[model samples]
Target: MTALGTYVKVWLALIALTGLTVTAAGLHLGSLSVLAAILIASVKSSLVLSFFMNLRSEERVFKVMLGVAMATMAVIMLLTFVDVWYR
Candidate 1:
């Protein structure tokens, strides 16, 4: 497929994911709600990073740096959640 077509498809997928996020938010899943939202957001962000940001075409070092940054963010989020849960 052409780049425009690919972008259109990605845009549609992102829209669908956004809808899913909204639907998930309306439900009463308690602890799982946050997990569902985070998972959906992660998927959306990855799609944006890979397609819109053109990260797939970048060098390995850039990908590695992004990975490190993502990992650090994940750690911080995890720590925050843990602290909140204990409170």
Candidate 2:
């Protein structure tokens, strides 16, 4: 498919994900709500990074760096959650 077509598809997917996030926020799922929101947000951010940021065409090193950064942030978030849960 053409670049324009691909962008339009991604834009539509982003909009749909945004709607899902809003719907998820309105639900009363307790602690699971936070996890659900985070998962949705992660997917949205990945789409933005891959398409809007043009990371798909970038070099392997850039992709590796981004993956490492994401992994680090995930670890930090997990640690914070664990600390909170044990307190």
RMSD (Å) per prediction: 2.6, 2.4
Query: How many steric clashes between backbone atoms does each model show?
Result: 0, 0
Candidate 2 per-residue C-alpha lDDT over 16-43 given as tens digits, one digit per residue, 9 for 90 to 100: 9999988988988889989999999989
Instruction: Name the runs in model 1 displaced over 4 angstroms.
Output: 76-87
Distance from true location, Cα of 29 in model 2, Å: 1.4
- Which of the numbered candidates is closest to the native, going by highest lDDT? 1
Clashing pairs in 1: none
- Residue-by-residue lDDT tens digits, candidate 1, 1-87: 238988999999999999999999999899999999999999999999989888888899989999899899999999999999998
Estimated TM-score per prediction? 0.80, 0.77
- The C-alpha local distance difference test score for the whole of candidate 2 amounts to 0.90
